[model samples]
Target: MEFDLDYLVQQLPALRAGLLLTMQVSAIAILLSVVVGLLGASARVLRLPLLSPLIAAYVEFIRNTPLLVQLFFIFFGLPSFGLTLSLFWSGVLALTLWAGAFQVENVRGGLAAVSPGLGEAARALGLTRWQYLRLVGLPLAVRSGLPAMLNTGVSLVKNSAYVSAIGLQDLAGVAFDRIASDFRAFEMLAVLLVGYLALVLSLSAAVRLLEHRLQAPFRR
Candidate 1:
């Protein structure tokens, strides 16, 4: 088989478009995941009456199952109950829920790591539960979990490729189409690999920078 560098170059435009779509979907899903993680973590930490168990079950189920199955359920199964979503929204929703599950545990672990003395001190200081969480708990949990959050972000970006399985025009989807047209499997797959690597590396760098900034005060 011949390596066709020129053929890969010719497909750059489509691949670039696909990359942009992947980034857009990933950005939205990551944001949603963070929100879900924070809320779920808080519920578990506080032991909210009924909500905690539900969140726990959700986290367990999502973490245990394959994301592809979740995506298919969202895109295909929901229509059976008359709940339908567009392909892009379906991908985004599935990714958000899936990532959120792992993130919840990351945050919960961070919350658990908080020293018992701190909570006691907050109570002794007459800090309400809400204030204690906002002023003390949340910051500490986020700081301790920053690395895990970064890992989740990177995972989310890579997993966005799976959206291609549902006919979303993401990087993987576009590459598959191009490969089908030109029959340049090696070249297209190589480009796909490189594209995801660049994305993950860039995201990891940005997260590391943010982590450094967050740690600045502690260094002093």
Candidate 2:
């Protein structure tokens, strides 16, 4: 097989552009997931009668169903309700919804790690419910949750590749296009495979650094 390092290098600009889209989708989805995680944790913990039950039901449904199916339903199903979104918007929205489902569990686990004494102390101090949750509970929970949230972030980035199937030119999509254009099938795929492994490995390392920082404060 003839090699073309220069040609591949030239494509880097477009590939980088695609990575930007991947990052955008990831950022928006992560923010949405965090919000969902917080809301789910609060509702489940406080046990608000009606809202609690509804959120519980939502979590169950989301966790049980497949994300790909959910994406299809939103993209294909929403149009039935006269709601249409761009492919990019649809992909981001679908991922956010799916990530939110799994994130509920992360939030619950984090909140559980908060020492009960802290909450009690806050209550004794006459902290308002909002103050107790915002100032006390969330801060403690965030520390305990760091490792798990990082794990979820890794999963979210990997899953973002699926958006390529729906016409979003993410990393995977760019590689696919390269294969079509160059006919360097094996070479293109090998590059793509290694690129993903590198991406995930680098992200996992960053997460480990963050986990270490979180643990540092607790060390005697």
Which one wins on TM-score?
1
**What residue runs in model 2 are displaced by over 4 Å at the alpha carbon?**
1-4, 212-220
Alpha carbon deviation, residue 106, candidate 1 (Å): 0.4
Which RMSD values do the candidates have, in order? 1.1, 2.2
Tens-place lDDT digits, model 1, residues 1-220: 7889888788889888999999999999999999999999988888899999999999989989999999999999999999999999999999999999999998988888899899999999999877888899988999999999989999999999999999999999999988888788998899889999999999998988998999999895
Candidate 2 least-lDDT 10 residues:
184-193
Q: Rate the local accuracy (lDDT) of all candidates.
A: 0.93, 0.81
Candidate 2 lDDT over 40-99, as tens digits, reads 888888888998888888889987898888888888899999999888898889888888
What's the true lDDT of residue 172 in model 2? 77
Displacement of the residue 128 alpha carbon in candidate 1, Å: 2.3
Candidate 2 clashing pairs, residues 3+ apart or interchain: none
